[model samples]
Target: MGERLVADLIVERLQAWGVQRIFGYSGDGINTVLGALRRSGTPRFVQARHEENAAFMAVGHAKYTGEVGVVLSTQGPGAVHLLNGLYDAKLDSVPVVAIIGQQSRTVLGSAYMQEVDLLNLTRDVASSFRQQVNSPEQLPLVLDRAFKAALADRAPAVVIIPHDIQQAPAPELEQEHGVLTTAPVWSPPTLVPAPADLERAAALINDGGKVALLVGQGARGARGQVRELAEKIGAGITTSLMGKPYVDESHPLAAGVMGHLGTSASGFVLGECDTLVIIGSNDPWTEFYPPPGAARAVQIDIDAAAIGNRYPVEAAVTGDAAATLEALLPLLEPRPESAWRTSVEEAVQRWHRLAAERAATPARPVNPELAVRELSDRLPSNAQVAVDVGSIVYWYARQLRLPEGVPAHLSSTLASMGCSIPYGLAAKLADPARPVVALTGDGAMQMAGLSELITVSRLWPRWTDPRFVVLVLHNNELAEVTWEQREMEGDPRFDQSQALPDFSFARYAELLGLQGILVDDPAKIGAAWNAALDADRPVLIEVLADPDVPLLPPFPAGEEKGGTMMDALRKEGRDTQHARDLLETYLRQEEGLNRGL
Candidate 1:
């Protein structure tokens, strides 16, 4: 008999890659591999409630670890469930490996139970796809190629292991002893801006009365160069949400973010600048649409697909953001003394002051924005933040101040919900010593894989301390705020029928053996947050908030639903019958509480 079964060979390959853990849910088809893993005892198993959650957890792991996070699922629905997370990983440039099980080799085309064409289903999402491993002889090469494709492309890879093959006897193959390396090679591409292109960009900057730099996610690795360029040209900086951390917000040149949720400073700067130079950013909905229209735009990006995709550009320099910025810096002459820079700086200052006032106001029910700021204040200077999508995203992005060297993770392009928990887990797994927190909305958390909380409890017990805090801003309604916003726009019949039944997230956390705190009073928030962090365990703080409040600093003036709020207030006069009725409900509740006290 051959020394290795097909399953053992697969485990041997995985162990060589230095993979410490594989997040997965086992099924009959993949049980052979599980047994092999048990025997190897090198790469441990972290079981998840659902395969989707497994894939999501892997995404989180890769974000912090920068290693190839591994996920396993059975055939059919299991593999199907893994698709969303895989797509997320692909979009976010997180490296992951998904080991999926298929039906017996004999019944591959015969429609066996839990049998489906996973290869085709996952082709679009995964960076690399492979299947049909009949003998142990092919395992080493197939595995090697899959890892290369995944790490090199910085995307997800899927490997399908057929059931019959898993149990098959080994072939006469040489035992490879070396480790399987899967680290990405970040060599600078050969596409530098031409000398003429650099001169043109420099001339545009030097000649313009006022210039604004629009940075995006592609500027992530080029933060230093971005700051240097901004300083050299005395340029104002505004960023898309994905590019939030490109320039430190505290920097003198930082003008805040742009879009519907944009700050007043970014809008003001965009309106005043004669030239808008975009670097590594391509957010269509936010960056391009509400244009000042007259400003000349120049874009520099490594990906040719991004140029001319969102906003029209007079000059599109195809090169890396940092390198291009360096190339252009020397071509430009220093700006003569100009009031444009001073004027933009004043606008930014005014915006900052206004934001500070809003943050300082101690609302009775603790403003969500204030809550996020308080969280930022309490977190360690180097903590990693993973945020889920919703109204709260705007709140945190606007308020949370990331310290230098701290990396923040968010799914900006896809804007997927239910990502915070998994992302937080991945961050923690990648660096167990660093503090990792997931700021999530109440509705978003329900959609996330709650069972992964148990996985965190089991594997990284140290995180049980306040180190892992999942903050749930409990507004007690789904889609209600948007419906209310629409109702304000002259649609009295705007319905909030999508609101979910309120569930006790505090109880849910306790059930998972993690600390759970329900926060209703504004005064208790600080103490509760402090206690949670000090305890050093996994904690979930469910904040009860009034659902009627609008997500503030209203939408831009001419946006589609911009006038809806004002229209609703006008039609139903401030003291109209409906308003009186709602006020009566509030009065009754207030009186009831007073009497009880």
Candidate 2:
């Protein structure tokens, strides 16, 4: 076999590994890699505006497709930029591989133009694997190891290759045409819990009067089983933020989210249950954790380490959610309706009614909840939502009840800002036929999403299949965090950083040759979104809302008295309105339900 450039080998191996796209920015350090990509003509290189966005794109791709997301970048700043998104994948347990470029071997010790110690910069975040290829002969083995580690650990892996090494001659191997074998067949093994754990869990479920189910992303493929178990036991279902989209919102037992941005009805379900069946989720929020001593908890998870970490457990089943539930279901019997279960159901119903009332209320400066509700109701059948973190997450999570097929990709685990725009782009890349919508708060949009807007502009002309929409929840403040600082720290005044200066992100969208609409009126918000969905090019809709509106979680996250919230507002010279306003409508609806209204 003829000698081949190591660069060509790398790209060819990537193609053999089923990588269809490589998200990255080319630089002097990585020139050889990009050159090889062009020669191979198998894996397409998508040039991202920023290295960070490229990493996030890979993260989003891996998340939506359940495949290893691949990203590439030059050394130094480029490699450093990938950290944020890599950490995102790390914390979220998504599989991703990062290929970083390095200087020539000659400049290994010198402070060359682009030299920065890559290993030291990335070691903490890319915990699964981190290795640099030193020789041409080592390329295949190194690349293969990184790829396999990503799949096995469901975490990020980094590989750094020097330009000289990439350009070196590669040795022929034993395979046909002396083409060295790159990736071997790799797959994660399916796990099943032991019989004793299943039997113990089933026994607990059978003896308890009230049962509640808590689910997370690990329960994604087990939606049917989760729903079935809940229905059989007459149990209420509560989801961690990541699991919000797994179950259909219209399911009879669905009680919505738990923890920070969760729903009160879901909290009530957990508090009232005697047997709590927690599956998949390891959310650290104590408010959502199974209350100690009140219930016998049975947890099912693929990761054995998470079984009893969040709450005390009587039965901890270590297996896939679907397989574990299948083993336990036969041992359990149907549960009759009880007062606690009935109370939770009624609470859920009332909660929905109250949410609707709040969503319908017309705002003097526009209402975020109303905007989100309109979005939820009017989204096209195949629309995909990607919501950024901060106050807007509450609005999107609570008001937007996605239909059966629609998926909402979120930055929930990392809880990072500026993720929605890039996430929407990656979501579109995964499924080019669906309408992609990105929801962002004022602060989040300005943080990093604005640059992604430019990336959108650049990519708009290249494809026309799936459309894109960016919805900005414009409030000129971090509404949720503002409320939190006051309530948690008893702070007298909010940091000036909380209030974001007003910016017309829509106008910026127009400057980039895309459709942009700024709507301050409540009536225009829905119309703007509808128009954006039908537009040929990407569109940005900036809907202004009142900054004074309180962003409340499912329940109060504080242990102190009520004085903290009101007092802080007064000190800040902001609206000193009643905190009751946040829940007044809900309480009213609950009372009406009690009276059989």
Best by lDDT: 2
Q: Please list the residue runs of candidate 2 whose C-alpha ends up more than 4 Å from where it truly belongs after superposition.
A: 1-3, 174-182, 464-466, 556-562, 574-597
Query: What is each predicted model's overall lDDT from 0 to 1?
Result: 0.72, 0.81
Residues forming the 10-long window of minimal summed lDDT in candidate 1:
553-562
Put down candidate 1 lDDT per residue, 474-582, tens digits, no spaces: 8765533454454444543233544656888889888878889988877777877897777657788888764443444322322334345445644542343443333
lDDT of candidate 2 over 433-521, digit per residue (tens):
77888888889888889998888888777664547888888878887777788767767546575768878888999999999888888
lDDT score for candidate 1 against the true structure: 0.72
User: How high a TM-score does candidate 1 get?
Assistant: 0.85
Runs in model 1 with CA error above 4 Å? 127-137, 169-196, 286-293, 360-364, 460-466, 479-496, 552-560, 568-597
The estimated TM-scores of all candidates read 0.85, 0.94
